[model samples]
Target: MAYNDNDGDFPGETSTAREELRAEAREVLCRLVGREDADFHPGQFEAIEALVADRRRALVVQRTGWGKSAVYFVASLLLRARGAGPTLIVSPLLALMRDQVSAAARAGVRAEAINSANATEWDQIRERLAADTVDVLLVSPERLNNPQFRDVQLPDLIRRTGMLVVDEAHCISDWGHDFRPDYRRIRDLIAQLPGAGDRRVPVLATTATANERVVQDVAEQLGVAGADGSGEVFVLRGPLARSSLRLGVLRMPSPASRLAWLLTHLGSLPGSGIVYALTVSAAEDTARALRDAGHEVVSYTGRTDPEQRAELEQALKDNRVKALVATSALGMGFDKPDLGFVVHLGAPSSPVAYYQQVGRAGRATDHADVLLLPGTEDREIWRYFATTSMPDEHRARAVLGELEAAGKPLSVPALETRVDLKRTPLELLLKVLAVDGAVERTQGGWQRTAQPWTYDGERYGRVAQARLAEEKLMLDYENTSGCRMEFLSHVLDDPEAAPCGRCDNCAGPWFPTGIDETAKGSASKALGRVGVPIEPRRSWPSGMDRLGVPLKGRIPEESQVAEGRAVARLTDLGWGGRLRTLFTITEGGVQDAPVEQDLLQGAVQVLASWEWAERPIAVVSVPSRSRPQLVGSFAEGIARIGRLPYLGSLELVDGGPRGESGGNSAFRLASVWRMFSVPEELASQLASARESGQHGPVLLIDDRTDSRWTLTEAGRVLRGAGASGVLPFVLALNG
Candidate 1:
């Protein structure tokens, strides 16, 4: 391999040079896959030519497994041979980066990555970069703005960089299904790169899923104004259809029926693959249900540890497990070419997102199953996620006001006291603000910037409307009489959209709608098996001292509530759906109703199977401002069933703060402390029972537990009144 100094430097008149480059790329691709006849997919060569031979920015929007990675790996090799510097790739997820690093090695490219997981290896990687021994370097979008990297390493890399590749480029657009604020920094990064004279660094952005609007937005960002004031970008988009995927939709009557369907038919599905769930609890519960049915399965979600995720991914790849019940966290950057199925427990809010997830399957196989078991609660889940993604102008302004008033960097916790928002939403708002130039992060924390910030009300409104429109589009996808694959393709602006001839509608239904009765009974039993351990709060929230609560780390064991039990989580797929109806509110206010018989029976079953150290001797209800009848009936029913005395409810002191249902621990603790008190008569009875050793812990009952502060505070009052210990039992746990 040799290079003329002028090779691939000047653009627009290099037909011979371009042909030579493509020939070299073909050889590299062969080496990469260990095949002499390896070739590029349609439009892949054009994308590669734009970056390597033409020296122009390009966007490649193609389906997964379309050899998008091949284009970049081969281009890097060709450019390096031509005396260009290493390729810089801005990748999104750790899994994606790991896969790319290994793939690059096959083509004889030395690829290294700088990410959170490899902190210990960064010094070595930096040394490699400095010695010019690295052919390609992959970094997370967050690293682009990292304090140390931005101040030291980036400028040098920019001057020497050969090509810039933005993997998962859809993240750059606000309209994207998975947008991240850190990705917006790419535009500014491009502006800072040296572009003296007419020559500029070539950039290539790639995504497997992006609609027309997202494509335009990302292209505009990537094609930043060069030194010559040109913002030209070449885009090569192809059909979004996956020939290997056979799509179908099953409208189940309830969550139990869906679980029953999986239990009865999962093993019969072609081969090992993924089961997509909308929520973490759903994934976990589904995995458990499948495992209980004697199937080898695992659960993967955002809550999964990085090391564990790696192991799980490998387990799936090796076919050690039948399937990995997972959330969207397991979607991107995960590659298993022979994967045989992708089953969704609920539809995603957008058609683009659905396509992205389903694309994970049948990448290399001749056929793969794609089934959507749409749930009634899917729309509610979509609304929640949509609202969380959109920034609230009121909350944004409050954050800015607090930072401006401080005139100094403030930590997230310090800012939490002044703002009404919780930590997650607050952090998200700060990130958005930082991208909008309203505030900036520093070593200490975050500080306001000199840049004037105003709410983009109209823009945000448009984005919100767009989200709703996507929801509607997803609904259309579910109910459309037309081709499902074509509907998804049209949504992605694929000009080649047509009947896939492989989907359920095109080929007639290949899946059975009826579930076996035995499997249904087994699923119902697993879901109805109620009792989740409620781990007691071991420590108090910091800053309680400032609020006059006088609490700090490691709460005294005596003051702690004993481990308790809840009938179900509000996010659980089984009891959750029915329990949700119990809390539903009408137009004006809550529906004040007594406990339903079935739910009451479920609660009793939870108590019957509870593995308490000592059985509860008495039942005491916590004062409920809303749903008093429901709570009262639940407590009384428990007492009657156990033949235990009802010690009566805790007294809600007037003038005491009415506790909020949900918020951070600090505020929740302050609001509820001293608000609950044990009456003199019940206190005497409880103290007598403990003194006489006639009973064990008293069961403190509540309708639901969200923050758990109310339970903690009420438990403390009972403990102070000399009850042996306070054991909590609730109908539901709100995550």
Candidate 2:
């Protein structure tokens, strides 16, 4: 049967021809899949039609099992018929790519995936691209980033490329649930692809969740103009209510009891499910215990090989494995629609991560359950990692001593030679130290975590305060006083407009009485009409600025002038406290003499490099605005520059030389520096480096206009000096 042309935009003969081709394609797909009608969601057909009709870019954000693949598949089929060249779909996971290839084969669409495991995959993919045999090509970001793939010689294929679809699009956002540096580069690669007659290929970016900032960032990075165009965007909300999924949280008094409870529950629960542990050892031990208890269980962690992962997935799919104990590695894109349950043996670091993992169950319409097991051990583990995992003074000093004694910067391998820990732990230590300003990593070697281990209690205090603030944000999400689902949706920017009634708090009564009942009782009592005082609805302030503690005024002018020379004097006098405590300079006559600004700045750099300060200020710019706004603007800029790894713990201040800001203020200039291993330290530095006359390569965030601002040569000099534990001050107007 010929399908009618839903719209008349396709012109006389072309319209008739395209309609005939679509019908043929549909028939072919149906026959290939051996189905009378494709089992697709209602919206799937509409999305496909929109994609084919519109010549511009588009994004489709739909729920997990809502046939997102079909939308792209149908579009590819239509594009091929229209003589468009191969379509490329960049996937975040290898398994997802394989699944799409399998689905396309079933639908009679010629598609293939280039992944790492297969030896001949790259060559075959390249051949297909060159021969124009592949209608659609699926690839993981890692595969696309491979130098071999980038240098592949093919005709101006991008110009003929019909569609570039990026799945799991949230990875483009730094604030997303899954943040990957490699994913951020996809935008540049897409932009480099040759477009139809100099016109960019119609790009389509899709994901389950894309917040406002994320959406903007993704569009900008991909150079897609905006969310609206011929390449428009459509967000399809999935049914949040999974009534068949039973949700329960168990609180155990001890870790041993929690383990025991896990064993007991696994034995009692019927059908296949997942037990999510926080660590590799936990997953292994839990699986072992479950097996000992006579339960059919498998385990998976980051260490699991691809072959094993495939086997485990197959076993789960075929119902051969009754239960699988896993870590976070098993959550993303492992689509087992018939998952019976998801049990968290320990508390997840964040609710967003927890929800995503639990949501994996019941994708195929079967009733599923989710269990959260929080025990003392779990809490202890969380607290320990939250507080102590990162680098500190002693650790930094040890690393520095080792490096100095060796008389050279240490490579990853050489550093491993000195450290007793495994590679992962060592990397984590290095990362934390880098963030703490204790170390600097070169292209091929590592420096000390910080300059030296000098205690500055005041500096540590500020760092501690910052850490506390961060902890509070996490705590607010975990608090049971409010609806968990509502809190999470609001925080994570989920587009669902209404409260999800499926979560534990929403499903169960929050209080003895309903909200209306409580309100009525309170209203009556307030009116003195014989009732109870209205139960106050608790509220927490939203936005980071509202909750952040304000910083004190910039360090004194004399202290700034004395800088490191004065600091060295004090250190020599044995006035060392916690690193955070040395914010002010003491006036002990000779000890208080202001040293050259350069010397003082150099000392400050030394302290910062030594990890004695929260951040190393290569340049400080004083702009006339609130610190919060400045921090936010800088973060946006960093994301734009594709420098997402250099953001953490930012502070903004309302300081600069009045309406007439200083011309040479380090705060007023733009400077570039490589953010080695320090993610958190970079965030703090960007935040704290906001003050008039502050020496270093910093920019004054002018509230008047939004444009690219540049830093002076002096500012660049300071950035260089700071590279060697010195601060340079420069200033420039907001030209």
Candidate 3:
């Protein structure tokens, strides 16, 4: 709650007018919060006054939990009382929209939202809006681009809208921590909004995390161009410090050690909160491990189903679980007032992102803990996300070319046939292009725009450079000996950045680094447990017939590989660090060293734990040009240990091609089609091995399985040669 503080007053206001406005705001705020004595924070009343009194555009850059939502809800009430139409809030996340709806109702404002998850309620909500019953309407930025919403409904809503609120306004700026292309459309929405005579519609943009640059960007976006082509924006910035949070960083030796520390210490933390992991696999793995350790926890990631995510959110709010092992999915718009702690299994690439996640804790509490368990692989993960999200000129141009050639709107799947990019990267590229005015989304799909589009090379370069700078700042944060809270505030360009006297640096390390040996053993054992099943590819790639490959439809069951085992995922808590190093490319290529004892032991454990119906009669290596030594030695060792014959390596013929790291299944299969061949000697050996024991399966060993094309093709050839079955065994599975 932004308590009514009188020290900061609205400028250019008479004492008499200020008092009257304050009294009115107090009554409304009380109703909104359901507290008779509810008060506004220092600048909250000024923001509300700007919207309700002056009808001006305002940007509120305050700390999280500073009641940014209150300004809008209260202002909407005042505006509605004056015969203004319903308030239209453009929120980013569905979770945030749900919370805003609930919050608005408490204030007695009839609020409703139309989102993907609640299609059944949209008609009812729209009818309510049409009937002048809804006082406030919450929508996602993505909704603004929907064909029906944009073309059919938005114009009428704009003409009648009382106020416009951009929640999490930082998203409108590319410099912000979480940038969404959908947010760029909000600028156009604001520009097209009906003005009140000479004044613009009262607009309020609120965000908890924004540096000076982001603030300026958002302010510029909020301001509409006037007849004279000039506009003014009012900004209210408050201190970014969270006094209740005690921040600290703990550098862990490995992923397992970090989990071990969490297992040993999570119970001792202040209260139920979030444990953030960098990737979905990490979150699910950590959550499973913690649950096995007898902690009540669940994993929340982008992959989680929508209804399940809602349930998980409520579960966490109810404190039914100790914590949610979550990715950034649980972030933004979540309103847990008494969250006790936030622990990061890995450091975010930017301090701004770090602040956003940690801000979730201690929102309404006297004290809360924020800890970052930094990992050595943090930089690698950062680079992966950065590079993948960055715009590629080549890909963007390719998308435009495909759209132009089609001469009509083409759905994403239809365009996939004409473009070389995968669905995810392709969709991202299209979104970037849409924001750049290169393409326009239509009812059918997306069509090329006649508006000239140029790749802003300089802008892209600057974004990339800014990301690297943020990474450097995060490193500085992790290694800083100064006040942790102050360090974060400085990175956010907080004007009042100073020691909070509550952080670990200011009060000395308040967290324990020690882990009990018993907990350590449990975490290690949990992590070391292997056997991620490799479900065989069910169907052949779609375009294989066009590529001169004699394959289509479902793969023949006789030729398909059986469900196999991997020592671990490259993103796993235990063997991930080691497997990553083994597969990592250097200046030349993978180091090409033999498999180490630890990994060998892990593979053996996988083999032992594997529940195979028929024991392997022979072992054959997938000939590796990159990791021949490792693959050969592993296969030979497995054969030696399991007492099976070494049936020799599959031949990698000269004319055949190998798949790259990532692509569509069709493209991947094309690259690896007929890539491996069974030599005559190897074929004879495989037949003999099969004949020796009622045609037992052959263990096909490889360095790693990325696309699984290599394993599939090898299995095809072996089964073609009369082998009963082929079982794939790999050192790691890449996601």
Candidate 4:
């Protein structure tokens, strides 16, 4: 059989030829892999064809068990035969690397891994690579970070590296489901490689759970732009549905009852499966209890020995271990297609985490169950895990202090010492804080996460508190929600038309039916307030305005607006207008009113009335190309303020050039800060600034740049705090 590329221009010939080629390719792959017939879904085959003919770098987001690895394997063989150079596969897990290498060897292709597995024979592997005897090299991100690897002359030996593949590329994004700081540096390494200059080496990124942002981040990080544009990026819709897997929520009245339910379920569930415990000790103790109950059980956690982990993985694969109770560590890279069940003994901190853990079941084919056993103490445990040790105020102050002292990159250890916390807690706190732009980690040490704060402590604290509260509330929602599957799906932003009928809530008679979506909307509306209005007609006529606040009836430009006059006019109107508008209102009888009040009362009220108040705002604060440092500083300020109550819901918006350049920009201190500043603070004089649903109160930190802050209803409320113009307020700083 023969195949025609998808890029063909003639429809009839393209269709006929492509069919023939696909048949030929399938036969070749089946023969190569020793399979009777290559079994794959339609979606999987289409993805393979797209990748084969793709001109630009591409990403394959096939769901687990969709034969993504097979696509690459076939592509690798074809590319090598066509003299495209050896393929370089970068994977995060050693086990996965080993599996691919073994499969390749079976297909009569030369494959080798340069990891700890071959530590004793590293020189031999290097020799094989240098001699061009290896067809593919499976490596880890850590290996690429090695200084010796950076200095190596292997680029000359492997001058024609065909394809660069990054598996689980979402790790490049700090906000990804799984974040690894080291992954952020992979862009640099890719940039320095040959063939990755003007035209980047063809890159293939693969992941199962990457969201839109993550997909973009992966493409940028791997120097592959426009790869996902052709529907080549497959996203399997709908929740994982398996009827054989019993969905159960065991609500234990007490710890004793919870333990009893766990034991009963573990004993009764047939086939091997995972039992996820909330803590390390819980996992171990539960495993011990199961062992005592005459079941072959093993426990795994962060502290588990490497050898033990290997043993457990092998045992599970071989069906020797009946059950494995573990923390979240085991779910990441484990691919057991026939997992019978996944029992969560307690609530995970976030719905994303829960979905990931539950997804491990029925990966290859649907016939598994996910059991959520929420004990009375599970809520408390989840809270403990979600809550940051440092208050937002303390974190903001500490971050600023560190930045002032170091003036350079500082590692986590150094920051811990300065912040006066134990290493583990401090590290976790820093990671959380970093998400909100409170602090940033560098080669040296952690620095202030956001731009240097021009605002006082109270303002900074408000922003921080808002952010922390939102994170905690999200966690709380997960713990308390009645529909576990729905909650998980919501967090993932999956738009399934209907709920999974197989979930615990859906299957049970007690499923929550009375909960109306409108009820939530009503509650939000009831709590929201409308702000005073700034008559637009009165505020805009001013020839010049500082902030466009109406003076008399006209707004003035900053050049003409006096600070004192602007403040007086805003106070008298019980609202704040732009400085420019306020100047006009004071100088001329243009019937000027407060711009802040008009914006708050009008924009916020409209948003709230339209029920778009809760929609997440995309905050873009990166300055134009001319002002890079200001972009960074502004981003930092945004991130710092993103942690506040009314501000934390905003999404960081990035609009940088595509590919590795964009990915690298995401990690830059300034870029991160800008990304974190989606929900900025608004000036107080806007009457409706405090109105619920108005998307306002956003602040851009770069004073020199033309920064625009759009406010949401929540943001308006925060902005209303600056009713008196004398309250020197930055747009988002405590608002």
Regions more than 4 Å wrong, model 3: 1-7, 15-19, 196-199, 228-230, 541-552, 689-693
Clash counts per candidate, in order, are 0, 48, 5, 92
Candidate 4's C-alpha runs over 4 A off are: 1-17, 31-34, 116-118, 153-159, 189-200, 220-246, 386-490, 509-735
By TM-score, the best candidate is 1
Q: What is the lDDT of residue 323 in candidate 4?
A: 75
Q: Give the whole-model CA lDDT for all candidates, comma-separated.
A: 0.86, 0.51, 0.85, 0.50
Candidate 1 residues lying further than 4 Å off, grouped into runs, are 1-14, 196-199, 384-386, 655-660
The candidate with the higher TM-score, 1 or 3, is 1
By TM-score, the better pick of 2 and 4 is 4
Q: Against the hidden reference, what TM-scores do the models get?
A: 0.95, 0.55, 0.95, 0.56
Pairwise lDDT winner, candidates 2 and 3: 3
Question: What are the RMSD figures for all models against the true structure?
Answer: 3.7, 21.8, 2.6, 21.5
lDDT of 3: 0.85
lDDT of 3 at 7: 39
Tens-digit lDDT track for model 2 on 232-303? 334343433344565656555544455666554555564687888876656766676557657788889888
Model 1: lDDT of residue 373: 96
Evaluation by TM-score, superior candidate among 2 and 3: 3
| Candidate 3 structure quality by residue, lDDT tens digits, 44-113 | 8888887888788888888999999999999998889888999999998889988888988888989999
Q: What's the candidate order when arranged by decreasing lDDT?
A: 1, 3, 2, 4
